[model samples]
Target: MENTKQQKTNVSSKTRTLVSAALFAGIICITIAYFLHIPIGGNGGFVHVGDAFIYLAAVLLPTPYAACSATIGAGMADILTGSANWALATIIIKPILVLFFTNKSKKIINTRNVCAAIIAGIVGTVLYMIAEGIMYGSFVSAFVLSLVGLVQPIGSFIVFVVIGLVFDKLKIKEMIK
Candidate 1:
């Protein structure tokens, strides 16, 4: 039937679109992680603009692809930055950071996204502290590390706002199709 064939075609097209978005987001996330970092922590914690892309991916793409993009892209950054052990944590943390974000609306600067960014900053900082504490074998030391890590999400929130606004103005999300 034509309807059945059209359904198949739609599915195929959507799959391609999602995959392409994921790949492009991953590449961009990697680039941001590599270059835009502020060394503000004592226990090897640093602020990076990578989470902006992660949030962007989550906002612009579906959950599966957005999580995948954040996980792989952020994981790769850890591996490349001599923080290989943190790769797994990054994979887990990056995706989880966007768990509360629902990209249901086309409005990028809406309430859902702002709340998402704020919650992401809080949860991301706590999660990193726990992970780094376990890795460093000291909860206290991890707390200190988290102080530095706090900058990441705060900085990311700022980046996410500016970037999201720009994307909206430029109709970047619409152009994806």
Candidate 2:
């Protein structure tokens, strides 16, 4: 009975910590995306490193929590930064990016995660291209604009790798677990 009670307490505590971390990650995502964005394309698109936090959240938190962090943070940034048109797409796409990663890994940076990041980048780019094509009613224009869009995923991958290395060295995933 005592052990069971202790287990419950631990679970409750971990849940609180994870929720708090997700909230914090969301805020970081918004701050980086809104404040540090570089405007690109005529459709109010920009490239930002905010996705790094989303990637980190994916490798650290559970899937649902990571998805929430990515969707809320990226979507809120779009809304707050006068790019509300992209908010819906952001909400839809960001959570999908989280699906490519896993928190079950013992280390933040690993071969599987490295592959996941690459695949996620490609998937994110394609999804955004489709979303933009649909929104603007011109797949050709979207394709042209996607040339610029490609920078984001590439940049995000670099940022994620750098940050992931540091987090791995610090054993942040292990500590969180």
Candidate 3:
């Protein structure tokens, strides 16, 4: 009887943890995406720091939770900002970004993670540019204009490094244990 109760409790605790992580991470992602951004390149597109949170989610949380949060948050941000047209692209691209760099056992700045981050950034930028090219009916402006959006991925990596260090310094994983 006691063993059964303990097993149930463990499952409940894990469920709660996953649910809370998803909700909080999603909220943070959406808020960052919608409320914070920099316009550039004489085009209507903007660069936003929401990817920082997406990367953080991938680094710190389980992959499914992180992927869902990133997709939902960025997609919702697009909808709320009247760029609903980009929501589908965001949902697809952001999850791929998270999946590529996620390595819970590795340090964020390690050779593996850094290489992965650079690749992820390139993938993200290229995918977004492709989406924009399709939307704009001109590949040239989309490519040229979206180049500035690279700042977001670069900035995201920097912020990820800072947050990753802080989380490491604080022994954040131990807190869960």
Candidate 4:
């Protein structure tokens, strides 16, 4: 009975911690995406470091939690920043981005994650092109315009790798788990 009670307490504590971490990650996503962005092209599109946090969240949190964090964070940033047109697309794409990543690995910068980042970047760019094409009523134009979107993933990959290295060195994943 005592062991069971202790287990319950541990579960509850872990739940709280995860919830808080997700919320914090979401906030950081919003902040980085909204405030620290470089306007690109004539579209209201911008490149930001927010995806780095999304990648980090995917590496650290469970899939569901990471998806939620990425979706809410990226989606909310779009909505709050008057890019509501992209909000729906972001909602759909961000979670998909998380699917390419895994928190199962002990090291954050493993082969799977490296490949996942590259694949996620390509997939994300393609999805954004499709979304923009639908919105603009021109697939050709969207494809041309969304070329700038590739820069985001490249930048995010750099940020993720650098940050991931620090996190791995510090054993942050083990500590959190």
Q: How many residue pairs clash in each candidate?
A: 0, 0, 0, 0
lDDT of 4 by residue, 1-177 (tens): 999999999999779767856775666467556656877666667778788888888888878888888888898888776678788999999889999988899999999999999998899889999988888788998888668667888988998999999999999988886
Residues 87-167, candidate 2: write the lDDT tens digits.
Answer: 899999988999988789898788888888889888888888899899989999888878887788788888899989998
Clashing pairs in 4: none
User: What are the TM-scores, per candidate, against the unseen true structure?
Assistant: 0.87, 0.90, 0.86, 0.90
Candidate numbers sorted by lDDT from highest down? 4, 2, 1, 3
Candidate 3 at 35: error in angstroms? Answer: 4.8
Where does candidate 1 stray beyond 4 Å?
4-8, 39-44
Per-residue C-alpha lDDT of model 1 across residues 1-177, encoded as one tens digit per residue: 999999999999898867766675667556655767665545545678788778888887878878888887887777777767778788888889768677777767789899999999899889988998888789898887777677778888998899899989998777765
RMSD of 3: 2.3
What are the per-residue Cα lDDT tens digits for candidate 3 across 32-96? Answer: 55645766664446788778777767766777877887888888777776668778888899889
- Candidate 4 residue spans exceeding 4 A from truth: none
The runs of at least 3 residues in candidate 2 whose Cα sits more than 4 Å from the true structure, single-residue gaps closed, are 1-4
Please give the lDDT score at residue 128 for candidate 4. 91
**Residue 111, model 3: Cα distance from true site in angstroms:** 3.2
